[model samples]
Target: MTNEFVLEAITREFPESVLLHSEPYGFLTLEVKKQDIKKIIHYLQDSSLEINFLTDICGIHYPEFQEKELGVIYHLHNMMTNFRIRLKVFMPRENAEVDSLTELYAGANWMERETFDFYGIKFKGHPDLRVILNDPEMGYHPMLKEYKLEDGTRTDKDDKMFGR
Candidate 1:
């Protein structure tokens, strides 16, 4: 199906949930309410649209945005038609949490865990949520923009060489 048709169907089904929508590089991207993400994804999967494959789930940190400092992005694909769509939900950095998609897509288990490990975005209702790539004892989420981009204390690396 065409992007407009899918967008219309979703907007009709979730009139209040969709905040913004755009077609970038011909891909449908939607910014939706964080609370309704699970419901909207469920509808997309179960409805006639059949956008059933969960391609990926990732987290983003925008520390300067205040209320919208942290975000989660989800990509879905309709394998039969080779159509893909993206959905995003943003929340305050203080409470970066969202509904876990593991219940809907089995592959989401690891993706959510990785997002949590790197960006500190908790996935509520995830059965085995824990640090996947980082050490369990690590206290900070390194992917966050709050962290330093380079270690100033490293004596071996000269800042001048890097034009810093």
Candidate 2:
């Protein structure tokens, strides 16, 4: 179906859960309440829309956003129609946890782990939530904006050469 139709369907079904909606480059994008992510996703997958494919799940960091510092981005696809939709949920860095989609989509297990490994976003009820890429000893999430871009102590490299 058309982006307008999907947007209208989602907004109508979860009026309170949807915080914002947009169509960026003709792609339907929605910013939803963190607590209602699972419910919203379930509806999209099981309802008449049939957006059943969980294309991707990733984490994002926006240090300047105050309470909405940490977020999760979910990309869903309707393979039959080749349609896609994106959903985002944000929360305070201190409470970067959301419901796990593994129970609904088995493929979500590794995606959740990877998001957690990079952004430190916790997926509640994730069966084996742990660092999937980084060393377990690495206590911090490298993808966070708090990390510096370069090693300040390095003497062999010059910032000017890199056009920094």
Candidate 3:
């Protein structure tokens, strides 16, 4: 099956759930509503399209977007066909929560935890949701845009080590 076949299948299944569709780097990327993410992904996993592999799941932070400040990105692959597609569901930072995919894919457990540990995006109904990498005392999501990327106050020189 070709990429267009995959896109057509999704658009046909959930006409309204899809917010945007784009092909960048020849990869089909879809922006879908947060509420429909579970349904959409469940469909992709079971439908005749056979997009059954949960290749990766991650989170993104766009602090300036307000309503779309936080997002969860899912990469799916059809192992037999070697076709891959990406889906994203975004929501406001205040309500950075979505349905858990553990019910559908066991691998989602660690990926969700890592996303939560870094971006603070909560996966509702997850059996265990806690920090996997950072210390619980860290208190904030380090990947969020609210934090600075670099410290300008550094006086100690390490330029050579960084190839600067």
Candidate 4:
């Protein structure tokens, strides 16, 4: 439907959770409070909008950005009408725990894992939370702005280090 209709429904149904609404790039984006994510998801699922496809959920970290310290970006699609919406939940670096959407969407399984793997945003109640790409011993996330490469050098030690 229209962005105004969606915004009105969301604001009326969930006054506390819906933080902001924007129509950028001709798509409706709802900035939701992290704590009320489950409620919002349930509403979306039950609404006529039929946003059944959870296209992607990824994490973003902005060490210098002022608006938010960390963010979890969620993109959902309504396959019936081919409409889409993006929801972003902002969190501080110190307290970054948004309710897991896995219960609502099974496809969120690997998406959440990948977000955790790169941005270190923990997904509570995740069935199997582990490193998807990086070595288990790698403590720091390589995607973060603070991540540093070792002296910008490509030495033989690098090739031999991981047994490549």
Model 4 lDDT per residue over 1-164, tens place:
77787778888889988888888988999999898887887788888767778999999887776457889999988888787888999888888777788889998989998888888888889888888888879897777766444444756444335332
Q: In angstroms, how far off is 27's CA in candidate 1?
A: 0.6
Using TM-score as the yardstick, the better of models 2 and 4 is 2
Off by over 4 Å in 1: 153-164
List, residue by residue over 1-164, the lDDT tens digit for candidate 2.
Answer: 99989988988898898899889899999999999999999999999889999999999988889799999999999999999999999999999999999999999999999999999999999999999899999899998877556688987776565543
Where is the poorest 10-residue window by lDDT in model 1?
155-164
Mind giving the per-residue lDDT tens digits that candidate 3 earns over 70-164? Answer: 99999999999898999999999889999999999999999999999999999999999999999999999888766444565776643454433
Error of 4 at 137 (Å): 1.2
Span of 10 residues, lowest total lDDT, candidate 4 = 155-164
Could you tell which candidate, 1 or 3, scores higher by TM-score?
Answer: 1
lDDT of the candidates, in the order given: 0.93, 0.93, 0.91, 0.82
| Clashing pairs for predicted structure model 3, backbone only | none
TM-score of each: 0.92, 0.92, 0.91, 0.86
